[model samples]
Target chain A: MHADYLWTAAPLIVSAPMAKVAMPKLAAAVSKAGGLGFIAAGYHSDHLEDLLQEAEDLLQEGTAETPIKVEEGTPKFLPVGVGFITWSASLEKALPSFSRYCPAAVWLFAPPQGFRDLIPWATRIREATACRTKIWVQVGSVSDAVEVVEAIDPDVIVVQGLDAGGHSLARGASIISLVPEIKDKLQELRPFPQKQIDVFAAGGISDSRGVAAAVALGAHGCVLGTRFLASPESLVAHGYQKALLDASDGGTSTVRTKIYDKVRDIHGWPEGYDGRGLINRTFIDHLNGLSEVKNREMYREELKRGDEGYGVNGRLTTYAGTGVGLIREVIPAGDIVKSLREGARALLYGPHNVSKL
Target chain B: MHADYLWTAAPLIVSAPMAKVAMPKLAAAVSKAGGLGFIAAGYHSDHLEDLLQEAEDLLQEGTAETPIKVEEGTPKFLPVGVGFITWSASLEKALPSFSRYCPAAVWLFAPPQGFRDLIPWATRIREATACRTKIWVQVGSVSDAVEVVEAIDPDVIVVQGLDAGGHSLARGASIISLVPEIKDKLQELRPFPQKQIDVFAAGGISDSRGVAAAVALGAHGCVLGTRFLASPESLVAHGYQKALLDASDGGTSTVRTKIYDKVRDIHGWPEGYDGRGLINRTFIDHLNGLSEVKNREMYREELKRGDEGYGVNGRLTTYAGTGVGLIREVIPAGDIVKSLREGARALLYGPHNVSKL
Candidate 1:
C-alpha cells in the first residue's frame, strides 16, 4: 500500500525554478519524471503568457505517457505548480497569469508585510479555481511564521530557513531553530481557529536526511533549490553548474542586499528584504571602490554583463542560500529525489530495522 | 593500478571513542577488517597504554587471518594511529604513549600561539622511528595555514575546514577558499620546501564529489571526522549515531567555545583557541552564564550525573564538525572511503571532466 502511494523510483525527483534557470523544458522533464514540477514566475521578460503556454505545452507533452486522471467526481488535475516571488507578484502586470493559466499552486516568497488587505484576493482565487490554489508564503523567523499563520492563513506555509536559496523572509533565524519552533508552535496551537496548515521546510534541504530532519521538525516535506540548480534539465549555464559543484563551506559567502535588484532594474522588493548570492570578481572590485563607484552608471557595467548572459563573470549574483555549501555535485534531479526519499526513510528507520521492514 | 591497490571485500573503518563506548575488540575488528583503526587518546585519563595493549591482544585472539601489514618492508605491525586533541597535546604527561607506542602521526590541534618549538621535538620522535610521522595540523584560515606550513614543515598537512567534525581551528575563512589558497601558496614557494608537501582537506568531505573537489583544488586527499564518528565501530552512543544519521543541511549548529573544556575539566587548550561542537539545550541555557559556574566543582556535579559519559546531556557538547549536516548514515568508514574513491574517480573520469586530475 505504501509502495503505491510513496514515490520510490529512478526519477522520483523534481526540478524547481530558479531565476533565469527554470525554463519550460526543465519543468516538463520533472513532470515527465513523475515528480511535481514548478515554473518560477519571478524574473522573466514581458512574454510571460507565452512562457506559461510553453511550460504548459511541455508539461502536457511530458506527461503524455501517463495522463493525470481526474476522477469523474474529483475537482481537478495535479501535475505542475507556479511559484512567484511574493514581492514580485504585486508588480503592475503580475496578475496577468491569474487571468490566464490555471496553475496548480501559486508558491509565494517573502510574504508581504501588509497581509491585512491581501486576504480577500487570495480567498477569491481559491474559491474561483478548481485547482488546489495554495498561498505558499516563504518565511524565515518564527514571528514571521506566526504573522503569516494569523493573517494570510496560507494553504501551505513554506518555512524557508536561512539555508534556503533565492530570496528569504527569515528576519534572522536559521532554519535549524526556525523549523522545530514553527512546527512545535503550530502543533501546540492546532485544532483551534487556525487551519490545519501543512508545513514544508526549505533552504539547504539538499538531500534525504534533510527531508527527514524537516519531517522530524514538523514539516511534511522539503523544498530543495541549489541541489536542483545543477540538474541537466535546468537552464542554468554549464559554468554555473561547475561553480556550484566547486563550492564548499567557504567557497561562497552570501550577503543580503538590493544592490543587484536596483542595477538589473527589478523594483518593488520590500525594504529589509534582500537576496543572498555569490560574490565574483566584479563584486570584489565594486566592494574595493564602493565609495568611488557609488553612481548607478558604474554599477550598470556590472549589471549589463548579467543581462547579456555572461555567466559568473557579470555581477549577476548566483543567488544561492547557505545550503550552497552542501552542494558538491549536479546529478540528475531525479537521482537527488530518489536519494532524498531513500535517505530520509533510511534515517527514520534504522538500517537494520529498514532492511527487516 | 588503482583497482589493485584498493580493497574490494574488506570492511575496514575508523572507530569512535565515546568513553567506555569504544571497546578493544572493536578496534581489533576494524584492523582485522583491513582498514586503519584509531584509538582515541585519553581526554580525561591516562589509560591509553592499557587500551593499546588490549587492542593488540584482541587482534591476536579475534581472528585466524594473518596479522595485517600496513605496507611492504615495514615490520609486521598493526595499522593503528592515535588521535589527540591539539589543545591537550601541550600537557606532555597526557602524551605518554608518544614514546611507548611510537604513533605514526600525532594529529595536532589549537597549538599554543608560539608552539613552533614543540614541532621539532615531535618531529624528531617520528624521524627516529622513521615512521613517516605526519603532523596533521587543524587550521581554518590561510594565515593559520601559512603558520602551520612555515612552522612544522611536516610530512602531511591536514587542513581541517569548517565542514569536518570535532574541534577545528577557528579562523573565519571557509575551507573552499583556504584549500585553493594553500595550494597556490605551496606552489608559489616550492624551492624552499624540503619535499612537495601533501595537503589533505577535511570537513564536510562526506562523499566523492567532496574528495574530488578537494583533490581538484590541490589537496592530496581528504579527512572525514563526523562521518566516522557515527560508525558502528565508534564509541559514540547509539542515540548520538541516530542524531547524526537524522541530521540534514544545517542539521547541527557549530560553535567554538571553552564551555565543554571547562565542564570536562580537560585543560591544556590555550586561550583564544576554542573547539567547535554541537549547540544543545545545556549550551542555550548556560552558555551565557558560563562565568558564574566556571568551576571544576560544578563540572564534577555535571560529570557525576555523567551526562558527558553517556552523551545524553546537551551540555556535554559533542565535538562534531559542520559536516554533521551531510552525514545521514553510520556505515563503516571503509565503505565511505571506497565510495569516495570510486565516486571521485567516476566524476574525474566522467565526460564533464571538471576535475583537474
Candidate 2:
C-alpha cells in the first residue's frame, strides 16, 4: 500500500466534506482504511471546541482499538483533515476555532474574493502545529485554481469536477482539462524548491478506473463524497441508499438548484453555486417560480406538507454527486477504500484482457 | 465506406428522424459526408407519396450535384433509411408509407407488447421490395431487446442508452452492456444469420472516441440525435441552439420533469419516461405539482406566458438525449457528419504510441 502510494499507485482516497453527513465514525473508517477523512466545519463555529474534542477523541479511540498495523513498529494514527466552506469560516466568530484546532489539513471550500486574507491566518496555525497541518483549497475552474494558488499558496489544492455528487464550484472548463491546466499553472508559479504541490481531484470518483484516471491526469489523490454517502457508516437515509442502488450507469442524473438552500434557510453561499439533488415532488411544483413560494406564505405551506421523511415523498432533496449512478449498494467505507485501491491496481498491472460488461 | 460498413466499422452515427428537419438537403449532407441519414415519417401516412417522391427527387439532385467523381458504377446516392416511433405511428397508420417508400432501411422506436405483429408486416414489406429494406427496432433495455428480437426477428437492433436525449421507450440495462448483450442474444437466436444481425449503440455518443469505443465493443454503428439537434438545418429555435452551445463538456444542468409535457398536452408517455431540459427559473417552479395544474382549467394562460418564439418554452419540450452535454456549439449538419467520420477514422488508424489521459 505504501509503495502504491509513492509510485505506480492509485490516489490516496479521501472522503468529501459533506455537511451533517461527514460524521466522526465515517472519518474514522476512512482513516482506518488507509484513506484520508475530513470533518466538515459547516456552521460549526458555535460548537467548534466540542466538535474538535469529539473528532480528536474518535481518532484516538480508533487508534487505540485498532492500531495502524502496516508494520510492527510503524506509527498507527493515520492522517485526518477538517474542511470548511471558505466564506463561512471567514466570519469573525469562526476565527477562534479556525485558529484553535490546527487540523491535519484545513480545507477551504467556496473561497472568498481573495485567499490572501485567509492564508496568513492559516499560516499561523501551521506554524503552531509543527505537525505540518497543511492548507488546502477546493476550486471548480482553472481560473479559480490560478487565483487561489497565486494568492494563498496552499500546500495542496483540490480540483472538483462536475461529476461529483454534491455542489460543484466549476464555472469553466471541466475536470478533464482542469487537472492538466492546474498542473501547468503550478509549474508556471515556480516557487522556491519548485514547490511540490499536490492536486486532488474530486467528484464522480467511484471505482478504480475513476481513481486511476484522476492520478493519470496528475491529481495526487481523489476526493469522493457520494461514494462515501453509500457507505454503511454514513448518516444518509435508507431510502437514499436504495435510490443509489436502483440508479443505473454513472448515477449522472442530478439537478443543481438553490431550492433546498432557500427552503432550509441556509445562506452564505454565493449565486451560481447551487446544489445538485434528485427531483422530488416538492421540487416539481415550485421549480418554475421559486420566488412565488419563497415570497408567498401559502406556497411555502404547500412545500412544508410534502417534506416527508426520505423516500416517502419526492420532497426530500437527497444530495448526491453524478457518481451515484455507479453505486449499486451500501458497504463499509473501509471496504470501498480497499476495492478502489485493488481495482486501480488490477487495471494498471493486470493482463491486457477485456472483461465482459 | 461500404467496405468499412460491411467489415471494419461500428454503427455509431444515428440518423435523426427530424420530421421536417430530415429534408433531402439534410439527409444528403450527412450521407455525402459518410454518415447514415434517415428520413423521418411522422404523422405522414397521407404525405408518404409526396415525401417519397421528394426524397427520390432530392437523391437524384444530390447525385447530379456531387463534386467528387466515382468509379464507373459506384452508387451515387448513399444508403438512406426512414424511421418511425412505433407506438406513435400505430401499425394501421404507418404501413402505407412503408409500402410506398420501400426504403433501404426502416427504423422503429418504442416497442409494443405485441412485437410479433411487426415481423410478418416487416417481412411483407421486404418480400415486396425484394428484401432491400432491413427492419430495425430501437429499444431501451436488454429485456426489451430479448422480447422484441425473439418475437419480431428484426435484421438490426439499436440499443438506446439512458444518455439519449428525448423520449426513450426502453428501460433496464444501460447502453454500455445492452449493446454487447443484444449482439450475444441475436447470435444465440437459432435459424438466424448471426453475422447479418448488426447491433448499433446509441445515446451519449457525441464524439470520435465514443464512436470508436462503440465499434470496439462490437456495435455496427452509432445513433446520434442530440448532436444533430444543434445542426444549422434543425428547425429548433435560435434560443434552443444557444442553449445547446452552452451545454459544454457534455455537462447538462437539466432536470427530467413533466412540466413542459403537461403544458404542451402531449400525453400517453409511460410514467418512468421523463424529458430532460435545461434547468431554468421556469422548470424548477412547475416540476413538483403540475398534476394539480393539469386538473385545473384556464391553466393555458400560464403556459402562454412561458412561451417564446419557435419552441423556446412550453411549445416545445426540448427533446434531447444525454449527448447534449458533449455539444459545445451549433455547426452545419454536414460538418458534424464529416468531423465524426474523420475523427473515428483517425482514432481507429492513428499512430502506434499513445499517452494516458
Candidate 3:
C-alpha cells in the first residue's frame, strides 16, 4: 500500500494535472523521463471508466514517444496519478470504476462548499482502493491547508499561489510569500511521525530556476501546469498550441477572470476561483459576467467559429501561469522533464551562471 | 565620468530610492555595507541643498548604528547617490543646489509626462556639472526602455515590475516575468559600446532568494524597496512602521490604487501612476475616490491619530511590496545587505540548501 514512487520520483518534478491538456501520452512520457506525471481527471466524470480502461491499454501498449519504465535506479512510475475537482460529480460517477484501477497517487482539489467533507471522501478513496493510492490535497490558503491536513492528514499538500493558471486559492499571496507562510504555519503542528507530509509549491514556476527557488523556499518539490500545457504530448488542439507559442510571454495577452469559463459554459467550478488565459475579444466584451440572451449568444457564435484556440473574435481559453513568458517553443513531454532536471541541477549544484541553461 | 560604484558595488544590492522612507542614515548604512544606497530626492524639491549638506555631515560623522566605511578590497561607497522624481518641481527649484555637491550618481525617474525630454535634461546635468554623476534612468516598459536607452544612454535601466511598492511602469507583469522580458527586449540592440546599460530588477523581491532569483532571471542586480523600509534607519514613523509590521505579509492589508495618494494630497505625480500600501478604513470607505469636504476631513483626522505604522482606523498608507510578509524583524540596515549578500552567494554558488540562511 505504501507507494514508493513518492520518494523514488527522480528530480523531484511532477507534471501538473491539467484538464483537456494532460493526456496518457504526456503522463507516460513524464514518468518515463524520471518525473511523476499526472492525468487530469477533472471535467469528465461520465467517462471515468473509459479513461481508466484506456490508461490500462496505454500501460500495456506503450506509445512511440516513451514507455513507462520502472527500472532499478529509475523512478517507479506509479499507476497514473489522477486529479479530480472535489465538488465535481466525477467522484460519484467514478466511484465504481476506481476500485478496478490502482492509481499511484490520487490528488483532490477541495472546493469551498464540500471542503469540510473532503476527509470523508478521501477516506472513501483510501478504503475503496485498499489504500493503494497516496492522497495529495491541494490548498490555496494558509488556513485552509492547516484545516485539511488536520482533518484528512494527506500524504502531500500543494501550496497553490495566486499566479497559478486556473482557480488559484492563495487569496492574494504570491508563491514567494505564500510558501514560507504555509511552512511557518505547518511548523507549529506537533510531530506527526506516523504521517509524513510533503509540501509542493504550485504557480508561476516555468523553468529550472523556479524549481531551485521553490526548493529553497521549503517546498519538497514543485508542480508546474503551464509548462506542461506547452508540451507536445498534451491533448490541446494544434491550433491552441500555436496560439500558446504566439502569445508565449502572455504579459500582453493574458488576463485572469471567470469570463472565459462563462463563455464556454463550463459551470460547477466554485466561487472565488478564476482562470488566467490570453485575453480575447469575447473576454474583453463579456468580462462583467456574461448575460444569457445578448452576450452569451454572441459568445457561442465566437466559440463555434473557432476550431483552434483562436477564432476571428480572438483566443479561446488557454489557461496559463504568469510565467508563460518564459515558454518559447512547444517541446516533447520527456524533453520538458529532462530540461527541467538539467536546469535545476545546474542552478542547484553546477556553475553560478544559470541563464546558460 | 567613471564611477567604480556601478561596477564594483559587491553583492549588487541597492536600497531603493523610497521618498520619505530613505534618509541619510539608511543610505550611508547600505553604502557602508558595500552596496549602492540612495537618498531619495523627490517630494522635497526646495530642500535639495540642505539634504546634500546633511549627506555631507552624515558621511563625515556617520550614525551610531552604522558608519560609512571606505575600506580596501571593498567598494569606496561613492559620493552618495541621490534620486529625483523627474517631474517634481525639484529640478527647476534645485538647479542651483545641484552643482554644489558632486553626487556619485544622479538617478532620474522618468515621468510619464515630458519623458521625451529626459535625455536633454541629462545632457544639461552633464554639461553643467561637467559629467561628475553617472546618470541612471528607471524605465517601466520594454518600449520605454528602448527609447530611453537610445536617447539618454543611461548607465543602468531598472525594470520596474508591477509589484513595486510605489508607482511602477511595468504593464501588468510581475518581476519574475518582466526582468527577462526587458532583457530579451534589450538584446535586439546593436553594440552600444559607448554606453552599456546594466539592468536591475525591482519590485516584490523581499529576501536573499529574491536576490538569487533576480540574478538568475538575467538582472545585473536587484533593487529592494519594501525590505529596506523595515530597516532601523528608515524614516518611517514608529506608528506607521508598526502598521507595516502588522500588515507585514501585505496580502491582507495592501491594495494597489491611486486613492491613497489622492487621500494624502501628494501632488506632482503623473497620471497612470498608483501606490501600493496597507488598505485602511479610508480606502474601504472612500474606495470610489474620495469626494471632497467631509470625507477628506475625516481621513485627515484619522491620519493624525497614529504613532507607529498604525492608527485606530487601521493604517493610513504603508507603501509596501507584495513580499512585505517576508520581513520578520527590523534590524540594522547593514545587516540586511550582509544577509542578502551571504544568502544569495550561498544559493548561487554554494550548496543547494539555502533555507538555512
Candidate 4:
C-alpha cells in the first residue's frame, strides 16, 4: 500500500493543507510539480465534494501539460490529498467523498478524544476507498506518535514542531530534536520487518534549506505551511499575503495564542493546541487587558477593512510560522516545489556546498 | 584571523561552553576528536588560568594519541576556545588569560548594553592574542545578527534558537527558520568580496542527524550543550545526569524560565534572556504562587540533596535543551564528536539513505 504512493522525487515536498487557504489550485499545482499537496477539509465536510471536484478538474487539465507519473500496479486515485480537523469533521459525510473521489491520502490532526478517535475515521476511510487512500497522522510529541502508530498504524506520520504556524501542540519540541526522538521511539516499539511508516517533518520550514534539514533529521520528506502562504495559488486574501511579506523576525513578530480563535469564536480546538500567527492589534490589545467583547467587536470592524485589515496594527488574523521571515516574494506553487526539490538535492549531495568542509 | 581557526572536520561539531558543566577535560576531549571545544569563563574571569592550564595539559597528553591537524599558513593557537558572559565578564581580568593561552576563538554572549559592548571585548582579545583569537558572537534573532555584524564584523556567528538550553533570548525562532533567514540577511548586508563569516547553529542539536540538519540549514557546524551533559568528562552531578537520562518528551519536560536563576541567586542576565532547563518542583512551586523567599529556601534545601536533587520532583536546576530526550546514554565526548561527524557525513552523501528516494 505504501509503495503505491511512493513519490519519485528524491526528497518529497508537501504543501500543508491550511484551512480555507489551501484550495484546489494550490493542491493541484504542487502535485503537478512532483510534490504531494493537500486540500484542507477544515472542521466540516460540507464543501469537501466541491473542493475535490475542483482539484480533480485542475489536475485533469494539467495532465495534458505535465502529468504526475504513476508507477505500474498502483491503483488509480487523485494524486493530491485531503486534510481534516478530526475533532469536528463529520466522518459520515467524508466517507462518501472518499468513495466518490479517492484522494491519495487523508491527513488527520487534533482529535479531541486522542489517537483512538482516529481509529474509526481511518477504518471508515479505508473501507470507503477500498484501501486506496493512505492514512497520515500528524503528531507533535513522541507519545502522540507512538499512540497513533499503535492505534491506527498510519502509513505516514507527520512530526510537527513547536515552530509551526496555524494550529499545533501548545508545547512541543523543534524538529531538530523531536523528529529523531520520535524515530527512535517508533523503532523501539515496532522494530524492523513491519510495514514501513514514512515520517514527514512540518513546522518552521520555508525553503530548500529547511527541506534538506528535515531530510537530514531522518524525515523521508517535509511539509511546508507558511511558505505556501506566499504562493499565488493559495486562497489567501491580499491583506493576509501582504502581512506575511511584511513580517520579519518571525520568532518575535509572531506568537502562539488562543486569542485569535477566541475572537473568531472558533472553539473546540482540543486542549494543549493553539495557533501561531503574526502579532497584531488583536493580540496586543488582548495582552493589554482589552475586554473580550470589545476585542471581538474591533476584530469584526477590522475585517471590514478587507485588504487593509492585516498588518502590525491590523486586527485580522495572519497565520504563519516562525519561517515567515524567510519568505520574501510570491511564487507559483509549482515553482516553489521545483526550487525546493533542486535546492535540497544540491545541499545534500553537491560537491561545492557550503555545508561541506 | 578567521583562517587561523579553520577546522579540518566536515560539518564541524562543537561542544557548548555550558558554565561549570563544560570543563577542561570535556573541552580537550572534543578538541582531540577533531572538533572545536570551549571552556566556560562564566560570569567572571576568575579561575581562567586554572581551566586553561588544565586544558593545555590534557591536550598535551592526548597529542600522542590524536593531534588536531593544523593546515599550513595558519598561525598556531590552542585548538580549544573560551566562552564568556559579556555582561558580567571583566575584560581587564580576561586579557591576561587570552595573552597566555592564545585560545583559537572567544565566544561572546549576553552583552547587556547590546552588540557595541562586544566591540571592545573583541578588539582587546585580538590585540592580546596578536589576532590569533577569532571572535564568535551568539545571536538569537536576525536583528541581533545584523546589529552584531555591523557593529563588530565577527569572525563567526553562533545562531541560537528558542529550543536551546542555558541562557538564550526569551523569545526566538527555531534554527529551522532562523538559520536560513540570518544567512540570507547576512548575504544581503555583506555581499561578495568580504571576509567570510562562518555560521554555527546552537540549539536542540543532539546527534549526527542534527549536525547534518544544521549543515543543510546553511550552517557550517553545530554547538551541542545537552548532548554533552551525558559525557563523563562533563562536570555534571550524578543526579543531574540521571535526570537527563530519565527525561523523555523534552519539549514538554523542559522549559525556559528565569525562575531557576532567581532561585540560585544568580542575576544580571541581560533583559530578554532566560535559561532552559528540565522542569522540576522549583518551577512547579513558583508557578503555583510560592513566594520567592520561600522558593529560594526550598531550592537551597534541595541543593543539599546533592546527587539526589535532580529529577522531576527535585529542585536542582538541570539545564538542558529540547534535545534532552534524544540523548540516551553516557558516551565519551570524543566518541560523541566522532560518531556525530561520521553519521552526518553518511547521511549527507550516502547512496542507501532514507532521506533520498
Instruction: List each candidate's DockQ score.
Output: 0.05, 0.06, 0.33, 0.70
Please list all clashing residue pairs in model 4, or write none if there are none: none
DockQ: which is higher, 2 or 3? 3
Candidate 1 off by > 4 Å: A1-17, A43-49, A62-78, A91-100, A114-121, A169-177, A191-196, A207-218, A237-239, A245-268, A292-299, A302-314, A322-357, B1-357
By TM-score: ranked, best first:
4, 3, 2, 1
lDDT of 1 by residue, A197-298 (tens): 766667655655455445444455567777788788787766667666655443235445555555556677765567666655445656676643453455
Badly placed stretches (over 4 Å) of model 2 are A1-8, A11-14, A24-36, A45-81, A86-107, A110-223, A233-328, A341-357, B1-8, B23-35, B42-81, B86-107, B110-222, B229-357
* Two-way TM-score contest, 3 vs 4, winner: 4
Give one digit per residue, the lDDT tens place, for model 2 in A1-357: 233222112457888878778876787688767677787766545665566656667666544423432211111222566777766664455545445554556677775555565665466655555435677888776566767777767778898765555666523223444565566667767655355677887765666656654554456777888889888888777777766665543322455566666666667785557776655544565665556345334435544544234442445667766555556678999888878876654543345411221
Give the DockQ of candidate 2. 0.06
Model 1: per-residue Cα lDDT over B1-357, one tens digit each? 112213212211233332344445554555555444456663543676677667656655543443453342332233455555544443455444444554434455556565474575456655544554445555665556567767776555666554444555433333444565556556666756656666766655555545554544446656666666666766766656755665443323555556666666566666545666666544555655645355445555555544343333434557665555556677865456556555655544445432110
Error of 2 at A59 (Å): 8.3
Across B1-357, the per-residue lDDT of candidate 2 in tens digits comes to 243222112333656675455655565556555566677775344565566566666555443323422112212222567777554665565555555555656787653445664676576666655565677887765556667777777777887755566666322323434455455556666555643666777766676655654554456677787788788766666666776665433323544556656666667665456655555534544554435454233345544444342232333346555455557778887688767755654544444201121
lDDT (Cα, tens digit) per residue for candidate 3, span A153-174: 7888887766677766423555
Judged by lDDT against the true structure, how good is candidate 4?
0.87
TM-score of each: 0.53, 0.60, 0.87, 0.96
Q: Under CAPRI classification, how is model 2 graded?
A: incorrect
Report the C-alpha lDDT of model 4 over A1-357, residue by residue, as the tens digit: 326555437588899988889988999899888889999998888998899888878876645435464322323378899999989988888887887788999999999879999999999889887878889999999999989988999999999999999999988789999999999988888887368888899999999999889988989889999899899999999889999999999898999999999999899999999999999999999999998889999999888899999999899999999999989899999899999999988877777654446
Clashes of 1: 15
**Span of 10 residues, lowest total lDDT, candidate 3 chain B:** B69-78
